[model samples]
Target: MKTKAVRMYGTDDLRLEEFELPQIKEDEILVKIMSDSICMSTYKLVKQGKKHKRAPQNMDTNPVIVGHECSGLIVEVGNKWKDHFRPGQKFSLQPALNYMGKLDSPGYSYEFCGGACTYCIMPNEVMELGCLLDYTGESFFEASLGEPMSCIIGGFHANYHTNKRNYDHAMGTKTDGNILIMGGCGPMGLGAVSYGLQFENKPKRIVVTDISDERIARAKEVISEETALERGIQLLYVNTAKMKDPISELMAITGGHGYDDVFVYVPVKEVAEMGDKLLAFDGCMNFFAGPSDSQFQAEINLYNCHYTSTHIMGTTGGNTDDLVEANQLSAKGAIEAAVMVTHIGGIDSIAEATKNLPSIPGGKKLTYTQFDMPLTAIGDFEELGKTDPLFQKLSESCKAHKGLWNGEAEKILFHHFGINPKEL
Candidate 1:
């Protein structure tokens, strides 16, 4: 079968083209993609191309599709998966297969599988490892977001405290302890905030710092302080760029004790060092951002690391278990996956939208594969509503849900602008 997809050939070369797909083998499954969310890592891959470690080499001969955050319906199930999976079942993927410790992953390593395409094949390893899961979420977007949410979950899991002997250790965040989230106003930061607040061992106080006041304001809109208050958790947003002494303010908020858990969401050296400095005694700092540069380095105090027991760590993606937890939490409304989405568009916009993702403001960008329209920011839906009737409908949907997109909005959009099923 022939399908359209966004393929990365080299640096500055992402092409939306038609290509033929081979028949699925007995050990594989074919899926019709419903929704795919653009990730910052995907943008980085576009810029780095063959230079990216996980990205396939020789793209000029065999270009790979470029997306991993996606959800879909099974159109054809392999004989090996027939007992567990069936045609018409909805599913999402956990792309970090870690097969034989290989760096292979969908969107980065595969030619026949990726989220951005109209259709994709799930290989035997994915099925055997339980990477493909049945999705019972309200919307396909929520399923697509499961991957990013899992990364945040994995970060929280990686955080730990060590005793003086270093023999005794505790994993996960400190319960009822003060926490700091640097660069916490972005989409992934919002996810960390939402998940952190609703965590089983929740923090007593959470301080989110960002350089942009506008982002801080948007963060408030996405994960409201009122909700945090209702949960009996203190939530504070700070614009450190405008502060004369932001570190002093942060220290004062924590009563000079610093933060128990500090999550750094930006890849910049300065931000990483800032997060490291905010760590309290026996505190854990999670460098949540993945740097584009291979040789990226940041200055950290070795004295504090040895004497104070403060440590730094980082993780790239989540495991299958983390994805399952993320899906469950989002399904139960414990985490607001909708808050992470700020833009929506059709498949035709994938190439340009991905090319300019880093420059674009706001959260995740979602695409409906079967539609044909320019990318539209959720914030501009009201303005677009003045001229376009469909956007007017979308505006109403978002307004009804407290300015956030939801399953209802997805239904309205698909009803009005989605392609007919018969056409596919």
Candidate 2:
């Protein structure tokens, strides 16, 4: 069956083109993708164009589907598929598979699963192994983010207790004390902070770092759900641009003993090592962001590991459990999906957004598959008539006298005051 997908011809040359999507077999189900967000890791992949290197610079022999985080309701199920799933029910996929569990999984070598795509024709062997599940009132976007979340949950469950690479012991009621989060401006980084801030037995402080001063300023003001400030939830917002020695400052803030857990949300090797320095004795450091290139590696002081018992671990391409926990966490208020998504656009804008994501100011820009126009306002704020503050700020930044992401030059003036989408 033919379906529309944002096919990538090469770097920054994505197209909204129609292609034949594979049909579901008796054990497979069909889902029309409703919403998908471009995660930062996927953003780097799209910009690199490593999917099919042999393909021409601006052309493709095969169409590439363009998202990994997505949500949709089931529309069709064959007889065999019907027993485990039903039509019209909300569902999100746990996209990767542990090949040892699945004979139908796409590869025989190292780990292999399709990258981010609008929709997937996943194999039944992966599903029956119990990675994907039905959504239970969690926000569809939250459900889409499950895979990433699962890794965080799985990280905690890992034999880190027995992991002797770094810290041999951990001290906390629940979490690894004080977490330093790099790249707090983006969705994945913020999600890690949210987990650190809200999860039971969490750290004493969450120091969020990003190069963009504007994004960090906003995060300091609006990035939490809890009431008490002393719940190990200190927001150490810093200006990385001004720092000649950021690691020293990070260490000073944590009392030189360092954080119990430092989550390196970006792929920069230096940042990962800095997190290692911020560790207390026998501390654990997590590499949450997958580097765009395979050659990316961080150099940690092995002596620290030998004497202090510091542990270094990295994770990528989330598992099935990530989605389930992410969904439940969102429902339980650990995550606020509405606030996390700052921009909404359609297919064409998604093409542009996919190209410009790393450089953009907002956290995440999502596209609704059913919509035609890009950048439609999802909230009830009436379009500003004469002038609006946000619009005014945006206009000065855009300097075109039209709305942000305008293709047809439709000048949409946003409101200075209005109802929020989350309030409803």
* Number of clashes found in candidate 2: 16
Q: Per-residue lDDT of 132-211 in model 1, one digit per residue for the tens?
A: 99998868889999999999999998888888765977889999999899999989999999999988778999999999
Q: Per-residue alpha-carbon lDDT of model 2 for 80-134, expressed as tens digits?
A: 8777888777777665555564322221111111223334454566567675478
On a 0 to 1 TM-score scale, where does candidate 2 land against the true structure? 0.76
Each model's lDDT comes to 0.88, 0.58
**What residue runs in model 1 are displaced by over 4 Å at the alpha carbon?**
418-424
Candidate number of the best lDDT? 1
